[model samples]
Target: MDVVLVSRTQAKLDATADEIRAQYPSRRVKCVRADFTDPDTSAVYSHVGRELHGLEVGVLVNNVGLSYPHPEYFLKAAEDRCGDADGGKAAASAGWGPQLFDDMVRCNITSMVNMCRLVMPGMADRKRGCVINIGSTASRIPCPLLTMYGATKKFVEKFSRELNTEYGGKGKHGTNITVQCVMPGYVATKMSKIARTSWLVPSPDTFVKSALQTTGLEPVTTGYFPHTLMVKAIELAESISESMMARTVMNNMLGIRARALRRLAKEQQQREEAQSATATDK
Candidate 1:
């Protein structure tokens, strides 16, 4: 199997490629370094094409996405911290500024669309391929603070569903292309701030292992068993009333948002004090 990795950092890409090579010595691994936030996507696509020049790519995973470092009211985030330099970093630094919004859309939505466009035609012609789109539980559930992010994921779910129906039907184009949308609740990842894995929150590898099993069986899946149960519970709760279900989710999210805001505030204060002390010393 040939694995092609694409990301922003060359060093991280090299390390990941090395790990892949070490794990599967027989499999060919290629890495293409490109930042999805760039306005010019043509260059990124061109680089990816160049890297995939020789291989008959069988699987395409549209896994890249971005979210706000912490939850905030839409208006509040837009009005404040728009010009902060720490807009795109991890949780402690990320802010939902206008530029950050653009970057998020480009990274999360536009990249996936362009990648699909670049790869789908070839797959359709060959009549054998798999496209795995990584969506979020936020799309399926009611998430107040993560409004735009959830909206973007909703687009992904819709897009993947339509794409599968159009190209995956054996009767339509006689194609065998599989487009699977995997919406996960949470896994131990930097993005989710999940430092430790548990029964409910499995590791990425564990989630992927379960997700792969449901690939042609379901068009959309929660991926992990715990995530699936969580989605089902939410759906069951929704049977009472949409507003009640939303309120329940929103209330829980409010607590998370409050804690996140506190962490960011404390970190910012520490930075200010450190800078002040340095200036006094100088």
Candidate 2:
């Protein structure tokens, strides 16, 4: 059983590769830098497969994501950030917050979509392959502040489910691809070090390990253990009230916003300290 990890960051690719090598010694695994942001970048997947000599990618993990780094607004966080009640279509027309959203869609939504397409043909031809779609619990829990990031993720969830159910009954091209969506909580990556969200932050190792645990299955495991319980608790507490769900989601969003802001603050302090040390050295 060979594994394929599609990601953009070189450092993450390296770390993930090392873990795969050390942990899954019996199964040959390969890690390749896949920058799905570009339409032409998917060739890297095929190139890597060819380089692996005798390995064929039976398992594909789509773990690429972004928050506010994109250039357009797929999902608007601030009503005032966009336009009219019709979801700021006018604002987007006027170039208010569309750029970031579009960029996010490309990264969060489109890129992963391409990965699925790239692997489907081969998997379908063989009638045996698995696809893991990694999403954020943030989608299930409304993150008002994350704005476009949340919306793109929502799309990711829906797209994954639909794809799974669609080709689930019958294998396409003789290869039935099962798409599983994994929504994790806050993970401590370089970005996490800059922004600490109390929303069940886990180390990348833990998060990915859990994620790998249920790759072929659609298991929406929260990033933190306690937070996972909170999801059930929140659902039960608001189980009677449909409105409560929205309320709870928003409340969670507020917490996330605060945590994100605090992370930024901590990052700022670190930057200032580094600068001070440099100045002293001079």
lDDT against the true structure, each candidate? 0.84, 0.63
Residue lDDT tens for model 2, 127-166: 7777778787767765555667777888878888887776
Clashes of 2: 14
Off by over 4 Å in 2: 22-31, 39-55, 69-99, 169-175, 187-228, 238-282
Model 2, C-alpha of 113: deviation from truth (Å): 0.9
Q: Which candidate number has the best TM-score?
A: 1
Indicate which candidate wins on lDDT: 1
- Estimate, for each residue in 1-282, the C-alpha lDDT of model 1 and write its tens digit: 788888999999999999999999998887888899898878877877777676677899999998977776776566445324333222335555667678788888999998888888788889899999999998988889788889999988999999999888677665889998999998999999988999999999999999999999999988888998898899888987989998887889888876776676677777889989999999
Model 2 score (lDDT): 0.63
lDDT of 1 at 251: 87
TM-score result, candidate 1: 0.91
